[model samples]
Target: MAEYIMAEKNNRMIPEEDKIFALNARAKKMSEEVGRDKVINATIGSLLDDDGKLVMLLSVVKALKGLEPLDFAEYAPIGGTTDFKKAVKKAAFGKHRSSSFVEVVATPGGTGALRNIVANYSKIGDRVLTSDWFWGPYKTITGELYRELCLYPMFDENNRFNKKGFSEELNKLAADQESVLILLNTPSHNPTGYSLDGDDWNGISEAVKEASKKARITLFVDAAYIDFAGDEEEYRTFLPKLEDMPSNVLPVIGYSFSKTFTLYGMRCGAMIAMAPSEEIAAEFKLVNEFSARGTWSNSTRSGQVLVSKVYEDEDLLESVNKERAGYREMLIKRGKAFSNSVIEAGLPLVPFDSGFFSCIPLKDPAAVSKRLEEKGIFVVPLAKGIRVSVASISEEICRKLPGMIAEVIE
Candidate 1:
């Protein structure tokens, strides 16, 4: 009798738990043991009010409640409703009209969109490229799909985007692989909260255009936190640059409503492609839809309906934006408070612009995180740093955390 009775491929897959959620559970247990007010739970990625309650947009909630039973109960189309697709395009592109052919495919969330991209775009055992400082799930997704995740140093000595390093790695990858999938998470990136500016985007575009001469390049933009980044129109200025890429280079946007609409559990999002040709656009839709059918067949109808309704009605859209803006401001305040405190405490943090989470880069992240946990401060320790969720903590906690972390580090 063998100690293990699983397939060869499944043999290496060990039962592992998500570090963030595991820490969150421990935080909740501590909250119950010692009063909730005494513990600072910065492990969760979701936005929480100053009162430590999860924040949900009332307008979005009302819109969902107003939906007819059939609207939610009925199964959505394999791809998505036509109206929903249109709404997603409008939401993603904003005022930037592209000359290239575009297509959209509904996904469970941004994660599903990423999965489809990895499944359809890259071959097995191929390398998927991204920044070294990335969302941990990127590795998990690629590993599960029988692909490898590769990295480029995210920043330079000046703490700016490392365009040179990116181009170097991209060229290196293109030399070996015929097709390359590059995942760029920006406009409020996870953990680090770093957003690439226009200069950064320009550098990226130039690099991609140059690399496309040799290999087929799929530029995947994970824009999950775009809505919370900053000025709505200003943050989206980089989108138009993706329009004029070479025929071999495809720009795909992964849009998620989980953060924007606060519908995390609903798992609603879309994978949008800006193709240089009609044939490419058609193939993008067909391949992703086929992958969706094989995986999670249909998305949440209610969530799609909610987004469609919000975009379809001008007033509803305005209301939803207004409500969401308030929460965005709250998040900004919390982030600012934490940043300011870190500065005052002489604590070094990763380049943080605007987002739910920021990271403090230090050696022995796990050990430091354990020390923080002993003090009833729960945070997710990453490979290079500990992630502090400013969105989940109050402004007061945000102000206090830096000093506490600094003390622990010292």
Candidate 2:
């Protein structure tokens, strides 16, 4: 054994491993023991074909392959190239672009953007607000920065966005903290696949604006799954609402190419900040770049260049969106099939609307998940339920999965 030297922050750290990967590894081994078709592996959120292979977009791959060697060998600027930054902002805003001053900074992935936001936006020990059913990594990110995560019940009894609950929590958090950062991952939320519609966004905006009067507010929108959620333009309809926000309220978007461009390994994404005034936007850019320099130094150059090239070409952009539409439709179909099957099987689930994963509520999620695993079905067990990855399996499997889970739970 070697002596361990650590900072005060590092001293309290215990080994924290993601259970999803462990479950996936076990699923992979079982798949080998019994043929691949015999096992239901719904452990990961990544898009996978019926044959359990990774799905990549042809247009995205072509753009990457066509890149010059220099692109791969060089380092991107801390804030990314101008063209790439503009492309990301355009993608985030759609045609209804925000009139506020906006600044974009390249990060390794959406994860990096989340990390920066948690580290910089809130003071140490402040609670970052989100829904109860959220991506597990949000807690990990906040905890690492010495910030606590506070969650409101995600839905009401009627299975709609719990605007009332959210408002209550927002006010409570505002009372406790001088600065509040609200992170909403929507249009296909992780673990539950729950999405907020236009009305939901309006309520959220109103709540944030109201809270800003009592406490400085920073709203972070994590749109990593936006492309796969539904019609691109329709999902972005609420983005323009951020324009002309109160000076104390800052709206920042964390955009990722991992799912949109099928470039997960390339690790390219952007953090976009919108402010009522140009001075605030400039300050946002400067601090973001400074953070980038201190952390990863720069994002991948070729990844940034490829995204810029694809969006810049009208034909290529059209082709990419068309191809994505096919997959998005498939995901929607799979989601519907699973939800229908769950309803028919008399199994209860959290509300779902266009997303990669769904949650089936259970009293003992881990016990239920293990029982399902014994029958060759693997899923992630969350605090409130078992998370099924509709994005990873076939529609047929999705239809069959709920029945399998119901048998074990019931």
Candidate 3:
């Protein structure tokens, strides 16, 4: 008599598109009707040029095009090639010694890395901790793994990192959970554009070290937008802070070439485990490889080869960095222009420092987003705010956005 049969876990599944993609569709339709230049489409996270074209790095395109058919056809190692493992660690830690005991596993992208972490790190029915305002996928990933994502306040009254709230949450999780997985997305955080300062990192590490007395603490740093945030080495200075955490606390980093190399569709990334002991590091490698085998089996060999070649070849590396720098500047300019315009318009935003998007707290995000769409401006509506993708819109559009949002919000 049943209309359909499914597992209890699959009962909550709904066929639905993400809010950003839905708004992106509406933006495209509006653009077709009113002309692209007249419509500000800041619905997606990808970088776009002043001319409103999707920005693809010539370096990445050349690398992919240069690959042989065999390279594309072959299967990569389940955990990725040796060269890719080295390259990812180099990219993430730079000259930092925090990666001394780090082991790398190739993933489809940062999303895959996060999936492995949520699957292997947190116990079933346990809760993972992150900021209240976070990337929605974190919740979805945890839910699918039969775990939950808990939130701690992200900012204080002064709009600084809420160290006190974070410490409280860590203590609470340690008291109840056998293992706690903490996700910190920074150096250009999603939707909010908030990056943690060195002091903030120190406080977080200290808190985690203290919490490790009772529970296994795994700090998962999702640095998906690091390249666009600031000077690469400067942003990585916080890695050493994590290095000083107690042996019971493991620090894993998620690195993606999606934003960095403009290899979004290529889906190349790595999960790095910083284990205090050699035995632990080796075990991490084995288990993560097993996870990869059970999941995608292997990632794209061409993508892995591309990453290795770019890192190993000085000339190609220079070209890649140059292209990235150009886009990074464009993003910075757009962000600054938008921030200035917001201040000028007296529009309150979540203290944005650097990133592709900025969020404005709204009483009714869905309704406000609808109103903006009616005005030919499309943005993604979040639980508590409207996210404007400055990376996808031009500086000119960025300059005009705040006033429009202010008009709608006020």
Candidate achieving the largest lDDT: 1
lDDT of each: 0.91, 0.88, 0.88
Winner on lDDT (1 vs 3): 1
Q: Which digits, one per residue and each the tens of the lDDT, describe model 3 over residues 1-410?
A: 22345535442343356667787888898889889877988878889888877899998799889988988998888999999888998888877876448899999999999999998999889999999999988988898888888899999898889999999999899999988999999988997999999889878987898889999998999999998898988988888777787888888999999999888898899999888888878988898889889888898888899999899998998899888998899899999999899889997789898989998887899999999889998988888888999988989889999998899887
Residue 215 accuracy (lDDT) in model 1: 97
Off by over 4 Å in 1: 1-15
TM-score, model 2 to reference: 0.96
Candidate 1 similarity to native, TM-score = 0.97
Could you tally the backbone clashes for each prediction? 0, 0, 0
Clashing pairs in 2: none
- Could you arrange the candidates by TM-score from highest to lowest? 1, 3, 2
Candidate 1 residue lDDT tens string, 212-298: 888999999999999999888899998888886887999999999999999999999999999989999999989998899999998
* Native-to-model Cα distance after best TM-score fit, residue 15 in candidate 1, in Å: 4.4
Error of 3 at 95 (Å): 2.2
In TM-score terms, candidate 3 sits at 0.97
Badly placed stretches (over 4 Å) of model 2 are: 1-16
